[model samples]
Target: MNLLLVVAAVLAYTVSAQQCSTPRVRSEWSQLTQEQKGLYVRAIAALAAKPASNQYANPDIMGWHDFVITHAREAYWAHGNAQFYPYHRAMMWQFEQAMIATGIWPSNMGVPYFDWPAMSQNWWTSDLFTEQYLGNMNSNDPDHCVLTGPFAKGKYQVAFDVDNRRAITSGDTTCLRRNAVQAAGDDATAIANSMNAGSFAQFTSSTSGSYYDTTNYHSTGHFIFGGEGGDMSNASVSPNDPIFWLHHGYVDKYWWRWQNQCEQFLYDYSGTLMSANDPNGNGIDAKASADQYTASWPFKVQQLLNTQGGDPLCYTYSKSAGDIPLAPLTCPPVVKPSVAPTTAPPATATGGAAATSASRQGSQLDDKWLYTALNLLVKQKPLGSWGNAPKTGATAAGGIQAADAGDVVVFGRRDLNETESFNGTLEVASATVQADETITGTIAATIQATATVMATTSAAVSEPIKKEQNAYIETINPDNSTTISYTLSNNTIEIPAGFTVYSVMPISATAINETSGKPKRFFPEIPKLEYVQHAEAPVNVEVGSHPCHLAYPILLPESYIESMGMNYNKYFNAHVRSKMQIDAFNADNCTTMFSPSSMMNFNSL
Candidate 1:
């Protein structure tokens, strides 16, 4: 009886010690006491000090901030994809575990979140960012390093840019940096509207900031804190920042608000499962596999859907939207028709002089672009090699340009950006042709190319939220050159869901805002080609009715990509396409590029 009584007392004491006093009301920065704040900072710094666990010390693993980037990087999933909410929620939870293990976080404490709107006007001046606190902004540092934050000043050393693979440890031993620049798409009105969005896609897109839809808070935080060399902006080391947890605490609140606020979407859940490291590669996985997409966590996505029921239901935060007001519930539902119209084509015809066909009318290529005519020269054959055309006096433009003695011209030149049809039907009516007798031979020719023009636009356009379907075709030609491309079949930018225009605004005296909605010029003029429309068949002198040679060009353009500084061929499928293209490639299995109800963020942060 005496031993039993003693055991009961110990059990009671242990329970009392571990009672998580409150659910996650993660206090705002101003509410935390000096000790609480310092503990949080030091705890994260302590975790940063330890080498990654041997199990996770792989070269691809970077910093204490591994799981999120790992899934987003190696698994090639998460972020803007439909898994945005659940995946990040789990990521934050995992991060909290690390802090707990560090023995610095107060027992049973909650991670705090920053109220951007409340501090928007004077965020930088707050003591939360002083040399004694999180640290001053990196603006004063010439090397673009964060040297004043509490975690800076030798208080901690952490990894940076681990997503770059080769950078797992390269130059990682440095202070974090912050640019204090306003991330674009963070307007108050936009924020409120996004909060009011009806679907998961809409909500995720808005939060995607300028990179996806029309939201701001989440995006604004990333760029503002991670400008230049700041870890926040760098997806690889974003978690290294002490502020990362607090910032994401608010982001998690956004999800909870969408669900419980008036319970508008209490049981709502709808989105496609995309591939990423899943053995199946890139498509909808079987239910067993799909349910397990919580990155490297022990739990699944469904467990994260309900804050009140998840294993232990650890914490919660204030639902009051604070200074960044919640958007009105009246905002429109997110939708994308398979076919949305683009701008009309230019009227004046030049180059290959493509007849102005009304069927090809859609989005307009920027008029400022020097519309260089596109020329497709196919290698025709007398069995194995080209031997020039029939030398027949064929009429092309001013004069028929002769193919080098061993080549055959299929489609003549024209401004691909302006004249290339979105339908992709550059066809030749007949394969039979009467070329100079010497070049007589039948050849089955299929030359398909999809060209999408991505550039720094005239207006800062923000449409990164829509996760598009995969639109690509990869086929080897006899010449050994591989043609991999993203065909822009139904890539239409509908207003609201597919369009955004904004100008940068001043958030604070020290904060230099860089709004993406504002106009900015892009490089490489024409980044790459995206699509081809089905229309009038291509026309050129058909070679002899022979089927000796098979040739086609997909033209994703590796040369141009390198010239523009994009590591195009990082891997067989290391996606270097536009933000949407990359997302589409990972989501869909190289099929039609249409629309997905969920979000596939490009990690634009």
Candidate 2:
């Protein structure tokens, strides 16, 4: 039995090498040599030059636009649904094939990714928006056309209109446009929130919560670059922008990172065909399966799970700006059972408020004690709320301490400034199971915090400075086990006028148990928390500067509007006035605002 298990482990790990043999590595955009970039640019140009023949293709539209059209057609089904990750992964593979088919680039020329976190707050100055790369972020033209770069105006005619619904005829030509802005979720904080998600459901919700989830990199990545006139912002025709591939490449990398957390995650799949609230979804299965096919694609969700192992996905991500080294593709080593062994009860999860304990030796505390007390407090109190002082004789719902401890453990929110008054008697620390199996005993701990911000705008003394803050705690246990606790503190953020602030707070915890030499996760149910606070001084709008057109019904479909608790016709007038970019819309005094379209507008449908 032991030999058989060892053989199975070796077989599973070697499958990738046997199947792919030589996996192509996708590099960061800047990592590409000048010759590589030139080849890629030429390949894209070739795709854009050929006439499309697909059923969805428009008159005189290039082969490249075929992808944009397909993306638009499947937008409703592919996004805010269970297929978001898998579907995009398939699309990436397909585009790579198309690029190779163009005969301008080599098969090894995998699409490069833009690391949002690396260029987070300073995206405008990125090389991606330069003459040598994609193009200048914004255009002087009123239509916001790209006047430089390889895909400059008159070089590559854009096929779609502002809403990305209408395509031009043979005689008419439109230049690719850009209305750039600082995107949300481009910072490290947002990336941490995504990487720390415990389950696929939690991952999807935090990464792409419908169209309205600005905190997610998906929506913001498109919107900030796509701003009203830009093709990248519109969900349907976003692929029209060459930058779309790079953006999704990073997204794919993040999902890959999440899956590497455990062996189970590679097969982990769940969530409905579409958002449950979407009327079109009609309540399909909430749990997705590996056998399931991605929307509008022939590949199964299972095939897209692993970049190297997934069928037709034979590329690996090279160590780049916003990525980590790939985890080994080997199965865990098999361990033979001992003749006489002690077992620890399996860890169970429950949710609510968690408590924190500080040792008299400053920030150093006991790992087992902290985990037990926090888990205990969570079961009794509500999350994100302060725990009141516990009574002297009171005990938590599951009983105060583990079976071994004689003295009761009393804990709650104690005043930090209060004087310490503990008798010198040493109280024994205990957990539910043996010290080796389960956490037990009072062990030393060290807590460290690192902060990553989005944009920091310092104004004159009279004006308020715009600030966004996101924080998550990573605790290194005495046993070297790590617990990554995400705290979405229940506090309202205030954004001053003329600044954009994006913040995400983790309302729960996701911890990994690696002592056994295999990854095990403790995931408690963490509810989705949306906190959006925007404060701005109202400005008078000169409506005619930009056309006063309403968001098309197709763009803001009835089902989507209903999900957001908004009326189709009245939504713009009622909600957008206060939220729209006052500076961008006004054009004349719109220096503060990044672009003409509001974040909500970009997400409409």
TM for every model, in the order presented, reads 0.49, 0.49
Against the unseen true structure, what C-alpha lDDT does each candidate score?
0.38, 0.45
* Candidate 1 lDDT tens digits, 259-331: 6544435344444333221211221231122234354433345456656543324576654335333434643
Global CA lDDT computed for model 2: 0.45
Question: Per-residue lDDT of 373-487 in model 2, one digit per residue for the tens?
Answer: 2332232211110112221221121112222201112121111121112111111111122223221222111000111111112112333322222343333333323333344
Give the winner by lDDT.
2
The all-Cα superposition gives candidate 2 an RMSD in Å to the true structure of 24.0
Clashes of each: 51, 4
Residue 358 deviation, candidate 1, in Å?
65
Candidate 2 ranges beyond 4 A from true positions = 1-18, 55-62, 160-172, 182-185, 206-215, 275-287, 324-605
For each of the candidates, the C-alpha root-mean-square deviation to the true structure, in angstroms, is: 25.7, 24.0
